[model samples]
Every structure is written in structure tokens, then in C-alpha cells.
Target: MRDFLPADKARRERVLAVIRERYRAHGFDEIETPVMEEHGRLHAGIGGDNEKLAYNILKRGLDAEAIRAAAEDPAQLTDLGLRYDLTVPLARFYATHRGVLPTVFRAIQIAPVWRAERPQKGRYRQFVQCDIDIIGDASDRAEAELVVATLDTLDALGLEGGIVRINDRRALDFMLDTFGFPVDERPGVLITIDKLDKIGPEGVVAELAERGAAPEAVEAFRAFLMRPQTLEFHPYGERQIRKALPEGAPDDIVAHLAGIGEAVAAARPSTGSGAT
Candidate 1:
């Protein structure tokens, strides 16, 4: 619904330049991938809710009729779809070209990704995402560096007053399982969790119930959200996580945030914390 005029486009380009420069300074290499990718790749179950929101490219030519005959499977009618995010394509790219690339590769990806969703403030079906990823580095410092570099990019753009919150997918999965949330329902549950700022905890619980989450599971998740609301921003403790999220592997998070001192020292202007 938004189109850029000459002035707008110029402004956008300048901001992108700032982002690119910061990323480059961090030793990341820029790369581009096709906007359209195989449908299977886009819906490969690794993208959580992204796979469900994939905008399918309908079948064409005589093959359309053959696919139509088996109407039960809609995937048959779609051959290609726009990528939901750069991360998936980055993984695929690394796999395909690993032989030619260095063992430790830092990456910068900036592109528009498509999603089919209800429009809301600051949320659009199509929008540009500028992402920095550290590939093939198992060390937690790589993760910390990514956050520092991204914050530096924002600082370069003169943007302030934004908090950077970090969450681990493993931790989230553990919480979901602890509450007895169905495996297939985790993705849908996550969509509501991401909206906690826009819609409060009460709203999240209601939406989860509306979406067919078990009553007990909804209650447990709601309690988990309400626990120990602290204005102070300390990386969450392992003891707190173990008692609250019994299924959680607290050691993993302890390791993940081990390099936080580097990122914290690098970007002192921003407030950061690990949240449940």
C-alpha cells in the first residue's frame, strides 16, 4: 500500500547504505538470492509460522489440470513462491556453495519478504528486512557480534530509544512443551507471543484459547508471561528458568548469553535483556 516517490526512494537508499556500511565494517559479505524460490523450500517446516503464511504461486499450463484433479493437496498446484525471509535462503545458499566459501562466513542480507496477514500498524504484508547473520560459527560470540553490529547500524542511522530483546528458539520450544501445548500448535501460539507488546498478556491468553489451545496450556502460558515482572534488565537466571519452564535446558541459555558482555560493551546506548 506504500509507494516511494523520488525523494522517498533517495532517503531509503541512503539509510540502506548506512546499514550496509555498518555490516561491512563487521566483516560480513553481502549476497542476494532470487525472490522466487521453490515452494517446497519455502514450506520446508523449518520456518515455523512463515511456512503457513507462504504466498503460493499457482500452477499454470496443462499441469494445472492434472494438479486440480487432486484438489485435496493444494501444494501440488504451487511450484514456486516468494521467500518468506532471507534466513532460509541464506541456509540454502550456504549449503549449495559451501565448497567455494570460507569456513567462517559473516553475511548481510537486505530484501523485501512477503507474508499474507491482516494489516496492522507497523505490520505489512510486504516489507523490507535488513538482516546480519554469522554463519558456521558455533561460538556464542558470533551471536553477540550480530546484535552489536545491528545496533551499530541503527545508531549510524540516528535511531534511538529502541530496546533489543533476545529470545532463543530452543527456550521457547521448551516452554511450549512444558505447558503441554501441542507440537503442531506451537507456531500459532508463537504468533500471539510476538504480539504481546501490541496486545497485552490477557489478550494473548484469550487469543490462544480462541485459537483452540487447551485451557490448561493457556493458563500455564499466561502464568509464565506474568511471572516476576521486573523493570531491571538482567539476563534471566538458570534457576528461574528451571522452576518455571521445567522442560527448559537452562545450561543452553547460560551459554548463549555468555558473550553478552561484548555486545553490551559494544552498544551501551541500548537496553537489552532476555525475556520469557
Candidate 2:
């Protein structure tokens, strides 16, 4: 819905060049992934509720059985969808080409991705993602390297004075469970939380209500997100979380998220990217 004139394109190219040069200097090889991915793979528990924003491709070349299946379930009518991000297709690419890639592959992918989010702010349906993925490296060093590389790239763009925030996936899940979100609705709740900065607490509450979340759970989570003062973290986490967690939780209340602090301390440091 928007057009980039010559000035915009030139500025964009300059930004891209800085990022690409930095990625290469950090020893990341440029790679490409498909713009469209199989719907099944895109929906396979990645991208959280953002998966719901996928633009599904309708099934073509339908045989009689295929038509019947489509009639029974609308989801059966689609086989592929425009990818919401490069991560999923990159995963598919790695699986297909792992034999040729290095034992530890560091890749830089900059490309357009599509997502069907509500039109707001600068978040259009289409945007570019500059990604650095380190595959086959699980020592947590890879994540550290990524943060450093990203910071250097931003510095290359002459950007300064920004804060860095880290999200731990395991810790996020624990917090959601601690807030009493149903197991089935937790993913959507996580997605909503991701948007909290952009949409604010009230907006998140409205969206969760629209998504059919239990009223009490939504209110509890809103309050949780707005909690004040420092939490007294334990092996599992703060004592308050134990009170919120469901009966028969899979892990001990204080036993979860035990290693996160150590991991944060262990990550590679950046001159400017450290939290204040």
C-alpha cells in the first residue's frame, strides 16, 4: 500500500549495506530462504500466535477426494502460505542442505517477510527481517555471538544510546503458566505479551478478551505484567509464581528457570548492548 521513492530506496540501500557488511565481518555467510512456506511447517508450533496471521494458499488441482476434504474442513483447502518470517524456511532449508553446510553454520539472511497483523504503526503486512542464525551450536555461545553481531551492525548504522532486552523462552513459558493461562491458550497469551510495548496493557487485555481467554486469567496476567518491586527469585522463580501455578504443575515451583540467571551472566558482553 506504500511506495518508496528514490530517496527512500537510497536510504534503505545504505542501511542494508551497513548491516550486510557487518554480518559478513562477523563471519556470517549470506543465504536465502523461500518467501512462501508449507502451511503445515509454518504452523508447527513456531512463531506462536503469529502463525494465525499467515496468508494461506488455496489448494488447486483438486481431485474429487481433495474437493470433498476441502468441503469438510476449510484448513484442508490450503497447502502453503506466504511465510511470516525467514526463520521457518531457513529451518526447512537447513534440513534439506545440512550435508553441505559447516558443522556450525552462521548465516545472515535479510529479506522480506509477510504477516497479517492489524494495520498499525510501522508494522505493515510486509517488512524486512535482518536475521543471524547459528545452527548446530547449542552451548549458548551462539546466542551471545548473535547479540554482539547485532549490536555491531547497529553501530555500523551510526545508531547510539539504545537499550537491549533479552527474552528467555523457557522463562517466558514459566511466567505464562504462573499467571494461570490455560495450557491451550498460553501461546496466544505469549504473543499478546510480545505486543505489550507497542499496544499497551489495556490493548493487550482487550485483544486477549477477544481471543476468548478467561476473564480472570486475562486480568491476572495484566496485573502480573504490571507488578512492581523486585521479585525474590528462587530456583523456580519468585514465591508469588508458586501461588499462581496450577496444581500438579510439571516442574517444582521454585525449581524452574533456575539456570537462567547463570546463563545471562555467561553470555558474551557488548560495550553498548548491556542492560542499564
Candidate 2 on 1-276: residue-level lDDT in tens? Answer: 368999999999989998999999989999987788888999998778678899999877878888786786878888999988888989999999999999999998999888887887777988888788899886545665676677677777888844445466665676667667789887777777788887898899889999999788888877765666454322223344445343344554334332332343345344444321
Candidate 2 regions with alpha-carbon error over 4 angstroms: 60-72, 117-121, 209-217, 229-270
Q: Which candidate comes out best when scored by lDDT?
A: 1
Backbone clash total, candidate 1: 0
Model 1 Cα RMSD, 1 decimal: 3.6
lDDT of 1 by residue, 1-276 (tens): 478899999999999998899899989999998898888888877787677787889767747568768689777778999888988899889999999999898888899999887787877888898877777896767777776777677778888643466677777887788788999888789887877887899999999999998889999888878887434344334444455444446676655554554445555544432232
* Model 2 C-alpha lDDT versus the unseen true structure: 0.73
RMSD, every candidate, angstroms: 3.6, 5.4
Candidate 2 pairs with clashing backbones: 235-254, 236-254, 236-255, 236-256
Q: lDDT values of the candidates?
A: 0.76, 0.73
RMSD of 2: 5.4
